[model samples]
Target: MLPCPLPVFKGKNCRFDSCPSHESPPSSLLPSLLSELGVWTALLFSVESRLQKGQLLSLVPSQLAAFCCFSENQELKIMSGKPILHYFNGRGRMESVRWLLAAAGVEFEEKILKSAEDFENLVKGGNLMYQQVPMVEIDGLNLVQTRAILKYIAAKYNLYGKDLKEKALIDMYVEGMRDLNEMIMHYPLCYPGEEEKNLNFILERATERFFPVYEKALKSHGKNYLVGNQMSWADIQLFEAILMVEELKSDILSAFPKLQEFKARMSKLPSIQKFLKPGSQRKEMDPMGLEEVKKIFKVDEDLFLKHMS
Candidate 1:
């Protein structure tokens, strides 16, 4: 009733006409105090109430601490919301991340690196980890390395599986899918006269190697998903890998009935349904042979070819 010791708030009929300004708590002390106080909601409400009244209260130590805590908490809330994907506009390593998030029914935002400077800026910000794209900002951390990001998201969303055995199976299946996906991801970067050759190689590998693995898994399991009774990371990766192959050859699944059925069944999932529709985060293969990608990343044909090799 003594008009509240903190002078920033003028709640209801209370006024702080004579309250002395207290020195702000030391920066190191703020965190401990905030944790000990455990009154974030009350402090925030008081600040909001003051703001609503258009009263510009002079900053006192308590008010400064409250403001700082509120700002940091707000930032964490935002980072914990939608994930922010950083990559070139074209689909590359980040595409799998997109697919997994989509299938998990998690919406995300993208910071497409349209120029070298845009990428440099991220590196300068010190959040790019190994200075790589496909870096994701989520849950108050800048996550790098594609597999790590995927594993975290999958585990967070309950798609990793129920136990160690299931997770191991999912990992096995996903590794194979990653192998196939890497092939498809680099196919477009093939040398000028080697598109046909690369295309044939991808088809050969998919039919002779990758497709059969998943086909056999689905058939052997006799379930709707690849690794378990429920959908897991493997299922989403397989679904995405199937689509990537289909883009190259529409009838690629003709030989694998199980894969065909798996494709159909996966397409019916609500999350996958949303992703399949036009204008979703799902990206089309670069129409200009990823010319934009080359320009943005500043990679010449020789470099791409070398990387592919």
Candidate 2:
């Protein structure tokens, strides 16, 4: 949208200097790395660069803001009559929140951030930058970060856990869901060198560490959902981890049959089913790199043998 002002730099080292520096890549991968670095810069520097390019980006509106701007201003800055959710089109992470809100019978608005500039505008607004997307702009205030937003909305809609103990348990699994979701969404973004290390780390921890935890948690609960008999944020988060994103191999779902069932069961929810409709994808500047990055997360192949060994 912004005419690619910050062109993606392939196969070259980034100037950020702040990001963890690796040894200079060989000649073959240099261009690719440079290009990927440009995208990395765009995402990482969006908030910082917002001011400099504010005017240019102002013309490029977010899906959420665009929807809001066209509509007449209501008495409430945001309307509870119809709940609104701001999401990036193809990035379906917010669908989990959509599912949660729908099941809770909340009516609201849904807005999507269509471009990098749209994201820039958001963070430029101070409070808008807190945790970034899956943001819930209540009334006029922007609530960033998914977990906190989810919890806040859940509580607002009375989806909170039954008791202190239940709340704690609900939170525990929800956090697990949160961590796993992040890992799945981002593991592929790491550079090739970083991928071998990071992917191996993720898989090992996922298998030896996190898997046992999930397996035990599911076994102990002995139920469909993560916490109690009812659905919670954990379900939304876990279901999303399996449902959304690009991958290296089969993803985290195939090995864990319980999680597979968890995903299948969640798919049956009307709200979640409705979310399957095509959403716009956040276009990547570093197209070549995005694929490679996505592949880092793909573990369907014998990654353990190749990288871990």
Candidate 3:
């Protein structure tokens, strides 16, 4: 039998372990060889039997190259499979994306940009289509634009609704939720002196305008979800907006019974429950997070106020 040519590891300290040139093939290489041959069960047994009785299992140069390529491709597949979110470490535009993915039970990783250089690096890498943060790398595509990313994720995860009309409704409801979320997301960035004023504006709009829309939808639909009977992108966005508003005004839902009931029902979902846990991917907008955002984006209260106006 020809000896195995594959590199063998011995003791921890052995750096140059080698097998005899005439010894039987090692059992370690059997699985890879069997897998490459495309006959796992029967061929694995055959190879195992041969190895047990000291048989020859010679692999040619082409076979070795193919196996190496297969291993490399598998490694690449694993490394690129999980979605990577690139953004500042806070609840900005990326927060809705996070909420949608969590609701869909998809696991993802975050590349938190802590400095201007980090953002620049993303732009340099040509990953950000519009040279912006809140870019998500998923399914071998680097998705940018908050709405585009949200729509892609929603459609991919079967949360966009079942048909065109349902999708249109989901889109309409989501657009309203987006407006409400934008207000709450920027609330922390306002000047300290204007904080109360800005918060009051957000609360008034949320309670009087946004919350009532969702409240009536839930009430009229008489369904657990907003658009359709099942959970959709609109439902996810509504839940996220509700929580963000509640952060500013805990009693905001008291007057909206249907929305209050919707909140309770959505909260009990396993995925939503997981996201609401203390250590999940869900991020909170706070003083520290706000500072991080300002530092990373090089924005000040004036810039935020001007942009809002």
Top candidate (TM-score): 1
lDDT (CA) for every model shown?
Answer: 0.73, 0.52, 0.71
| Candidate 1 vs 3: which has more lDDT | 1
Model 3 misplacement above 4 A: 1-80, 304-309
Per residue, candidate 3 scores C-alpha lDDT tens digits across 1-309 of 222233332222211224422222356765674554551111222333332321223323221211111121121001224678987777778889999999998888999888877877778898777676678887558888889999999998899989999999999999988888877776766766999899899999998888888888888868899877899999888999888888787898889999888989999999999999999988877766666566666777566322111
Q: Is candidate 2 or candidate 3 better by lDDT?
A: 3
For candidate 2, write residues 1-309 as lDDT tens digits.
112222332223223333321222234643564365342221111321222211211211122221110011111121123445665553335655666776664555766555556656655766556434557766445676666677887777666777788889778777766676566555655566787787677666666666567667777778988777887766666565554331434575556777667777887887666655555222222324434422433333334112110
Task: List the candidates' TM-scores in order.
Answer: 0.76, 0.55, 0.73
Query: Cα deviation of 10 in candidate 3 (Å)?
Result: 24
Ranking by TM-score: 1, 3, 2
Better of 2 and 3 by TM-score: 3
